[model samples]
Target chain A: MKAVRTIAELREQIGEMKAASAKATIGLVPTMGYLHQGHASLIRAAKVKTDIVVVSIFVNPIQFGPGEDFETYPRDEARDLAAAEAAGADLVFLPSVDTMYPKPTKTKIAVSEVTSGLCGASRPGHFDGVTTVVGKLFHIVQPDYAFFGMKDAQQVAVIEQMVYDLNFNVTIVPCPIIREEDGLALSSRNVYLSPEERTQALVLSRSLRETKEAVKTGQIRTAGEAKELLTQIIGESPLAVIDYVEIANFPELSPLAAETAILEQEESVLMALAVKFGKTRLIDNCLIQPKGE
Target chain B: MKAVRTIAELREQIGEMKAASAKATIGLVPTMGYLHQGHASLIRAAKVKTDIVVVSIFVNPIQFGPGEDFETYPRDEARDLAAAEAAGADLVFLPSVDTMYPKPTKTKIAVSEVTSGLCGASRPGHFDGVTTVVGKLFHIVQPDYAFFGMKDAQQVAVIEQMVYDLNFNVTIVPCPIIREEDGLALSSRNVYLSPEERTQALVLSRSLRETKEAVKTGQIRTAGEAKELLTQIIGESPLAVIDYVEIANFPELSPLAAETAILEQEESVLMALAVKFGKTRLIDNCLIQPKGE
Candidate 1:
């Protein structure tokens, strides 16, 4: 395994690899370091699907807001390198901020509609930063396939649209959301939660699981009712403060009103939420594939 | 040269080309296809610099305004194919409008600053359209080098910024302006000019040349003075009506006051203009690199 710290070195290494094996299929797993089981899953999946797996770890500052956790974002390169290699990442690209952004960037890739709701509305300019870095990474790696965890469902949707819009050659493989046995979604930010706050965060996944069951059993008829139930569940935890509880049509993310009852013929819908447990903000979601579609 | 129309066919052909020669450097010359001497110059340049040249003939409708000439824009695949071949192109991509835009496109690639003045100000969303189509073409062709005629100086500037911002793995080569014996810049729209209007169109390039001379000789120190001189020269033609006459610092296109006289230490400036001869609009520009220290 190789660790490349510069774009030039990364490209050269990939180019040399291509020269060595012209038919090799390269896969990329892009992450912002502090590797957890979720990133390992993506890397392991890449290993199966591609001859070469490249994992990029860069804590992108552009994706964070003024008061966000960019300053306090975790970093442990030696640990990350070992974890990535163990998970079968053939090369680890660990680029510095200066290399990623050499100058004040003036070009922005904007996706509308899908980007307007969810985290897009809460943290302004967040998706753009994600798409920009992902786009840059895609070009640099020129991967045959790129793996993205479904934990960031909206991020996957935005990237799908960007790839379709820009006609990128790589295929985006969306992996299933990896969660703890206790139902908490795996995230680097999960480390930010204190012990008490960590237990309270369980409300997020519990609500989602309950809602998925209700949705399947037809107990929840409308998107509005689902939102109310989610809000109620998360609100009960004294440490939890709700940011948003949204139910939108799957993929398109079209908003559903309180009065917009779930249809008997509806196949799938998405339920997502964000809550602040102390200063640590966590997000989670689940897709409801209604029964008897 | 071979011509491929469908995106699938083009991609397949390019894939085969790569399979044959893994290290070949492809060059692209994107054009709207009334293939004038200007486009031929770009194609010729590509032939010299690249192992394979792909000239794309796409009359992008998105770049034209609602009442603009998109519907009536000139196209001739046979003539263009012949012209491109004559200029030593290896392949010609002649995608229909339907193929290029199969559905309503929601994504756009936008470049700022350099796209703010001159034609960008006169025609809203025009540069976005250019960048979008060119971006699509770049992805389809995956060229190592792309050529653009400097006749559309701001277009070149906008594309340069977009390529840089997006970190496209392509180098932009801005070719020199190709002109006629009477100094009229070669453009596909030149066909729209009536003989009398064509004669009057000389004022566009004439003023640009005169301004270049004035700036070089230090006779026009300030951007304002240069604009006045250009306006006066074009206004003298009874058939000419000015659209915009802008003098801005090169590349950046920053605003410079009319009273800010020329300085001995000045290195570069871009003087550009758009004028209407009857209903036909024509544009021309010159980049002045001042002599002496």
Candidate 2:
């Protein structure tokens, strides 16, 4: 595996590779360094379907807000490169801040409608930053397919909308979310969790699992009841502070009415939660699809 | 020469062509259908530097204001296709509105700073629509070079900024403005003018030519003096009503102070004017560059 840090060099390399093999299928996996098993799973999935795999690692600063964890985000290039190689990434693009943004960038890709609630509400311009950086990476890599883990389901939806709206000639593959043994979704920010906070964080996935179980048993029939049930389960942990608990229509993220019964009225909806254990903010979601559909 | 109306067919053709010759460089010229010599000049320029030239004819309704001339924008597919071929284009993409915008588009490429004044101020959301459609074309065609005329100087500036900020791989070629023998800049919209209105439209380019001559002779030293000269020359035509006549810095479109001397104080500046004769609106501009600097 080869690693490049400049846009020009990476572009030239990609250009040369395409020139050599016109039939080559390139897959791109964009990420911020601090490679967890979730990222590895994305790379492994791309390797299964593509002739070449390229992974980009850059902690995008624009996505981080004024009080967010922009400055203190994790970084370990050597370990990341080795892990990417082990997981079958052919080229690793690790661009410097100056290389990625030589000047103040004024062009922005703004996605509407679907970005209104959930993570978009709390992080403010978070999805804007993600979409912009992802746009740049797409143009740079010019891949045939791009793989993304469903851990950030909203990000996947926003990207899908952008690609469709912009008419990009690439396909977006949303892979399943990878998790720890205890069912906690794997995230790079997991490093920030202390021993006590780590244990408290399990409540996030536990609440999601409980919601899924409740829906399976037909106990939670409406969005309001679902939210109430989640709030009660998460509030049991003294360290867990619920930021938001939403039950909205899948993909569109539209709010489901409290009085509207959804027990077999609809196929399924999305149940998402955001909670804070100290300064680390984490999000988790599950799509409740009808069985055997 | 070949003409394709669907995106899938165009992409497939382009894909096969690229596969046959990886070194082939494709150039794209985007336009709305009524092709005049101005578009011809852009096509000719592209032919000089690329292996294959693709021209896209889209009316782009989103760029037009609520009360603007969108529904009545002149279009002739046969004339456009023949003109594009005669101008040395290899392919012409004439996508229908339904094909181009299959559904409501949610992705937008918003460019700021350069789009704040001039036509942008009068025609709100115009540049946003242009940038979005151009972005879609760029991704679909994946050309090596894209050409634009200096006739719409602000549009060229905004596109250049977008390509740079978004890291598009294609190079943008800014071609010279094409003009009629009477000094009127050739535009598809020029067809709207009656014979008398056409004659009165000469003031648009005459002001730009006079501005160039004044700057050359050091006659107009201040922005106020330049505007006064243009206003006097254009106001002489009873049929002509001056919309905007101002001097500003190049590219950035920053307003220059009225008292600031322009002849020797500044290396270059943009002198632009918009005028309406009868119901037809016209615009023309000239960049004043320091000679032999």
Candidate 3:
């Protein structure tokens, strides 16, 4: 992969690739530079549908809170380059923080209702960070489609709603979460977990899976029951602490107080949660469909 | 001119136009449907540079306050259509308010510092409305360049700042304000003025001209003097009630205080004022460059 450091260089590279390509479509898979299987899946998905794939490997500073590993966010340029090449990416952009966010960046793209809920509830400006950085990436890359992992379901939904509302000319494609053989979702933050906390992290994916299974078997009737089942399972895992449990409309992300009303539109319920396994906060989600017609 | 009412149809037309002629750039001029010479200038400029020119006539509701002219804003389709054809516009889009802003448009694209001042000060959420509506137009039309008149200088600056900060993929073209032969700027709201107020409204432009003269002969040194001159001019005109007099940064629209030190980076100054002559609010501006070394 040709690693580009400046936005102009990256845009020039993308422009050249677009000019030379048959499809003329540009895809972006933005990440913070630790290329794990989750990142790889997004890149692979992007390569399938678009002619030119640009992978941004910037560790966005605004996304990280003051004490939240902004400095320690991993950067392995050689490995990331190799991975992007293997994933069939046409360009790799590694912009300097200065280039992406100049000192005078006072403007922000905010999606109001959906952002104030979910992890946004816990992380304060987390979704704002996600949106603002993603917006910059979208503008710089000018991608026809952007690939994101469904593991951050709320993030994906927030991004989709933002695109729909803000009129960004990009499609958001949410790929299923990439997982380990034992079913733990793959994340770069997984590196921060201790061996014991890593084991305890299984509760997140396992609880989501069990709730999905219960809903399929009619053991879960309402959103409350489905949430309760997951709650009980997660409570049993001594090492995990719950942050929020939500089953919400796909677009609005408003938690369903009653059983989800009929899905009139192309809407599904998001069964999502964030849990603290030791000091690392891990999020997981599953989509809930209505009973078979 | 081909008239389109639906956003999907407008986008489809823009898409086909782009596909057929990639180098045939598009220039968009967005307006509320009250075609005047000021709007004609923007359409003419767009006609000069691009293969296709689109004029979106949407009277955005979000920008208006209660008791404001949201419902009463003038709409003359016959006049507008003739003017657009005369100006060589390829298409005229008169989208319905509901079509432009669907229900629950919670996403607002805002330029923070620039918006918080100026018309933003007197009219809350005005720039947000401007940014959001223009952003929708930018997405739906996907114009290579968009035009705005210098009469709405703060709005043009806010838009330029938004395009820069949000990384919108379009060049903002700030066209010169088209004026009547009387030195009064042409505006759609000019129709609301009574004959007597219409004559007195000339004070707005004349004050700006006099301010230029004052600064030339060293009568005005600071922004305060320029503001004071504008206020005194309106005060002398019995029919005119001053709304605001602003001396600000040319691009950022940040308020300039006389006591503040002049930094080298802050060179251009914008002097704008709004005065109500009867039911109509007349506005005008003059840009001043700093003294030479």
Candidate 4:
């Protein structure tokens, strides 16, 4: 495995690799460092599908809002490098703040509609920063396939929309969300949670799981009912301050009416949540397919 | 020469061409049909520098303002194809409005600072449209070198800034502005001019040339002095109605102070104009290099 910290070096290295094997398919896994099981899962998926797996680790600052955790975002380069290589990344890109952005970026890539709710609403300009940095990574690597985790489900949707709308040549491969044995969604920010808050965080995934089961069993027939049930379940935890409990159509992310029947809708439904346990904000979601004909 | 109207076919054709020659360098000349000597010059430059020359003709609607001439924009497919071939183009992409945009695009690429003034101010969202469509073309063609005419000088600057900021892998080659013997800049919209209006349009280029000569001879010193001379020279034409006469730093497109000495600036300076001949609007510019050490 090789490591690079500059854009020029990464391009040259990718070019040389492609020159040696003209038909080699490249895969990219873009991430902020402090790699956990979630990131490793994405890298492992890329290893199975591509000839060259390049993992880029840069904690882009622009994505964080004014009061967000820009200064305190977790990062561990040494651990991340080892984890990326062990998970089958052929190359790991570790660009510094200065290397990634010598100057502030004036160009922005925005995907509308899909970016209007959920995490986008909770944290403004977050998706713009994600799309812009992802765009830069796409250009720098020119990868054949880019892997993403459904852990950031809204992010996956926004990126897919951007790729489709922009006619980008690369394909987006979305992997499943990784989770702990107790069903708590794996996140680097989980490290920030106090021991008590950590246990309460499991309510997020539990509520989503129960909601999916309720919809499947026809007990929760409408979006409003589901939201009410989720609110009740998450409300049980004292430390879990609910930021948003949204039930919207998948991909398009248009809000569903309160009385809209989830099982009758042709498109898939997304039940997403953003909750704060003290200062750490954690998000999780599930996609529910409509009942088939 | 070959012609393709759909994105899929163009991609397949370019793929086959690249497969045959692994090291072939591709060049792209993006235009809005109605090919003239100016577009031909761009094509010819591409032929000299690249192994495959692909010219795309798309009159992107998003770039036009509410009352702009998008509907009346001139187009001649047969004539354009012939001219493109004659100028050494290997392929021409002629996508229809539906082909280029099957649906309203939700994604937008915006470059700030460089697109804030000059034509950008006169035509709101114009550069955004240009950058978005051009970005789509860059992904679609993945060309090695993209050729552009200096006729739209601010456009060149905006694109260069986007490519730099976004880390697009292609090089932007700015060709000199093509002009007629009478010093009139070549434009597809030239077809809109009446014979008398055409004669009057020559003032656009004439004023630029005189301004360039005056600055070179040290007769024009400050930005305010140059604007005054340009406004007065172009005022001689009875049919010409001034829209804007701006002097700004090149590429940055930031306005120069009224008293700022043009010759002392280290960066190249741009003197740009937009004027209406009856109902037809035309634009032109001249770039002045700083005195060398």
Q: Estimate each model's TM-score.
A: 0.96, 0.97, 0.94, 0.99
Instruction: Choose 1 or 4, whichever is better by TM-score.
Output: 4
Model number with the top TM-score: 4
lDDT of 3 at B268: 76
lDDT of 4 by residue, B187-285 (tens): 999989999999999999999889888888888789999999999999999999998999999888899999998888999999999999988989999
Write one digit per residue (lDDT tens) for candidate 1, span A184-251. 99999999989999998999999998877777677877788889888988888999999889988777
| Backbone clashes (count) for model 3 | 0
Which candidate, 3 or 4, would have the higher DockQ against the true structure?
Answer: 4
Candidate 4, position B35, lDDT: 94
Ranking by lDDT: 4, 2, 1, 3
Clashing pairs in 3: none
* Local accuracy by lDDT, each model: 0.87, 0.88, 0.83, 0.93
DockQ of candidate 3 against the true complex: 0.68
- Across B26-129, the per-residue lDDT of candidate 1 in tens digits comes to 99999989898889999999999998899999889899998899988887878888899999999899888888888767677878777888898999999989
Which candidate has the top score in lDDT? Answer: 4
Single out the weakest 10-residue window by summed lDDT for candidate 1 chain A: A260-269
Off by over 4 Å in 2: A263-268, A291-293, B263-267, B291-293
Clashing pairs in 2: none
Q: What's the count of clashing pairs in each model shown?
A: 6, 0, 0, 0
Better model by lDDT: candidate 1 vs candidate 3: 1
TM-score of 1: 0.96
TM-score ranking, best first: 4, 2, 1, 3
